[model samples]
Target: MKVEDITSSEQAIALEDQHGAHNYHPLPAVLKKGKGVFVWDVENKKYYDFLSAYSAVNQGHCHPRIVNAMTKQAETITLTSRAFHNNVLGVFEKYATEYFDFDKLLPMNTGAEAVETAIKICRKWAYEKKGIAETEAQIVVFENNFHGRTTTIISFSNDEGARKNFGPYTPGFIKIAYDDTHSLEEILKENKNIAGVLIEPIQGEAGVYTPADSFIPKVKELCNAHNVLFMADEIQTGIARTGALLAVCGKCDCQGHCERQATYSRPDLLILGKALSGGAYPVSAVLADNEVMNVIQPGQHGSTFGGNPVAAAVAMEALEVVRDEKLAQNARKLGDLFRSELNRYIVDSSVVNLVRGRGLLNAIVINDAEDSSTAWDICVALKENGLLAKPTHGNIIRFAPPLVINEEQILDCVKIITDTLKQFEK
Candidate 1:
């Protein structure tokens, strides 16, 4: 079909359905433009963006600062293949390292790339620093984890759809139950060659499963005691999507009261993406202290698009936007309001089982079977009601708006959600 023939939303959806891979089953609305907390469908219908592109657009869509940096850098120079040092890469490295409080930063193009980089760094650290034998080091991962789609990443995934027929999978990954410190401790005790524990601060793809209050600190303690690297995949929960700059900072008592405390559960290796470029570009990084990062020498691991000038410029601005705008503080306040409103609605409705999350990264569990399409149906209603959201698993819908959303917009969204849920109640 010609481009001009695609005038209606149905025609656009049909084009994608026929031409594109069926990897995603998105909401029927065809978004054509977005700004701040709202997106416009092809038919010029406006809707509150509750999903925020899976927490990638935490700074809001088409953020001016980030886009300007990207555009200027693109005009000057974009890619240099990392063979030669680009001007923006070092600047970005310094900014990112300081921002994340890490000694070094390895830039990559996507969250999955950062995760893979962390895995390699951890394993190399085990072999070179800890003197573990080659090919014997194991990393512990939690069940229901959504690290990425790489062959090595899926090797540790427990989801049948992600793993089935994709293996013969990569080995040396120990799977344990999530949010269970005792299980991790037991695994650590049994495996002397354990390299690291990679975990998401909040499991976004697994339906925003925030662990117990002490889970992060306890995991840090165990990793320290066992001499294992504590790798945090903050790609989804980082960049102020949670209350704090990072979900690891959730331990900080600075809930609109004081500045962030210096002491916190510091991950040995930090994987960041998504909001790193504020959804303007694909930018991800793995941060580590000298000791852990030094394990990988030259030519150990690298990506061509990694640390490109455009990505570097965009990421630097994106992080600045996060701090300057105090997106974390906004997420915290709005998140509290969102949960409170949803909790009130839940008291009278049977369609929603519960609402749980930290900051703007939250999800509502449906009072239906795990594999049911009730959440999808509700999302259809949400789209009709001028709000857009998607289900993570089968019966759980994650409502993560951009951190740039205001109080009035949040209240408006809450009403949309409540009204939509009430319709499902009958």
Candidate 2:
């Protein structure tokens, strides 16, 4: 059907089902507008945004400052392709490099592209700098990790659904148990051709499985000791969604340039996306110091719209919003309140097993089998009760609202969630 013909929610879903790729099974909500932490459907029914586009809309939807930047830049210029330098790319590079404490930044348009770029950089750095044989460098990745759907990125994924039939898959990846430092260290020690260790600070797609607090620091130590590059895929967990500026900054108060902070488990290469533009544009970046970032010279890698004018402008303002509004602090404060309130309710809960996560990146495991529809049913109930959330895995529901959400809204969401789960009591 034509765009004008798609008037109702059912029509929209039907159009997507009929015309678009059958890739995703989205919840049945036809959202028309969003502001702060609330979204309204086509029927004008308002609901709290609990998922935040998988933490993409961390700064809230249609963030005014980011939107203004995007509009102002788009009027003048948009994509200028890497053949000719744009006016804003350098400024963005300098601003972001310094903001994240990286000496250089390689901008990309999506989380997958950034991950691919990092893999290329890591492999090249190993061959050129670490003296490894070409194409023999194996990057260590974790089980249950979700970097992106790209073939190379998925090469390391353990999810059968994401990996099966997507091959003959890319090789040269070493998989280890998630959050297991011993196995990671053993792999690094046993394999001299290992180039980098890629990981998510919090495995968001694997039901927000936050490793032990000691897990990341130990991985960092082992990587350093074994002289392996540590690459953090913070696309889902970074940019203040996890309370701190980055999930690696565990409980850190320093808002800007977290690498210097002691608690920060710094990675040799940092991959970020989703909220980098405050969900205004596709802006993903890979950051590293000169020693690592400089490995990729001209013509080695780039994108036509990687560091476009609008992306640069939008991303700069997005970072500014995170700092100016102290979204990190807000996330931290509200995260504590959310967990405490949820934990209080969980004491009497049979539907919910437990709550686990740091800051706002959290999930509750349903007391049901992995193949069960309990979590999905609960999400539908949540939508019906004036909130919107979705299950990540079979029986795990992730609850990550925008960082801009206030305490009162959080409490209200908590009530809706608890009330919904209460209905599913076995």
Candidate 3:
């Protein structure tokens, strides 16, 4: 059925429930349109988009530049499998590689695919370059790390719901405590067969969990010392969502796109997605230098629609929008304001326990049991109050508005959030 034919939200939701796979338990807000920092529901009720499509719309929803690029390219050519080169792929590769200061980029459709690509490269590098024995390469990962839902990616994940029953899992991953430098170092030191350390610079799905200020850099330093690949899954925390071009870039003030500053952690392999196409397309990439990325040959690793022209055009425009808009600087300034405001509210309220995050990526921990519906309840209330947000876990509501959000909108949204929380305060 067509959207215009479906008059009620219930009917739309009912159709989805009946036919769609039960993979997600999303809030019942059926979004029909989006622009900038706001989205309109099926009922035409506008709300501040606090989630930014899980940071995929960092350049803002339906950004004109990105959309125009996609549409214009769509009218021309969209996909030409890696079997033959498209007109735009090489241009995008050069643009992206130079922009991120990497020697090469392996394009993919989603964050999970990019992650899998990084894993393949890392493992191959381990055998061919590092000279590790065949089938002995182990990649160190952290607890509560959310890379993707793929079988191999989830093999290292500790989340019971995502990991349960799905495996007779893949092996060669060693899990360690997150944010613990000593544990990471010890694991790398003790385990010589380790090929890489896959980590989220900021654990977004694990409740917007930002690590110690020094954690990322130290992890990179250790990975270097141990001759292990430091693969940063920036697919969520990247693209100016975390107050920097890359979350591993720390809080550097450069908005013209990262140039390997002193503050940058400099991962050996960088996985990026989500915001790469500004929610305009499914575009993700794994970037590395010659030594590491060259591990895989032509036939070994390529995707049918990975570097297609449409993705290439959309991604370039999306990245250009990020730089031209000074998204990193804006995210930094607004994030500080958001946390400061939310922090003040948390101190006085019984419903909220704390707000922790960097830049636009922040989350509030509800003062309720992990199993309680309090956070979800708060989000529903937020929806009614002209804002939209969702809980990451049972008690954690992540608030990651688009980097384009103005100061007034941030404050307005914060008011709506705080006012709603008061209803549940003890």
Q: Is candidate 1 or candidate 3 better by TM-score?
A: 3
Model 2 Cα lDDT, one tens digit per residue, 364-389 = 99999999999999999999999998
Q: What ranges in model 3 sit over 4 Å off?
A: none
Candidates sorted by TM-score, descending order? 3, 2, 1
Relative to the true structure, candidate 2 reaches a TM of 0.98
Candidate 1: tens digits of C-alpha lDDT, residues 260-342: 46536789998999999899999999999999988888898999999999999999999889888988888888899999999
TM-score of each: 0.97, 0.98, 0.99
Report the Cα lDDT for candidate 3.
0.91
Local distance difference test, each candidate = 0.90, 0.91, 0.91
The 10-residue segment of model 1 with minimum total lDDT is: 255-264
- In model 2, which runs have C-alpha deviations exceeding 4 angstroms? 1-5
**Looking at model 2, which ten-residue stretch has the lowest summed lDDT?**
250-259
Model 1: per-residue Cα lDDT at residue 213: 81
Kindly report which residue stretches of model 1 are placed more than 4 angstroms away from their true locations once superposed: 1-5, 255-263
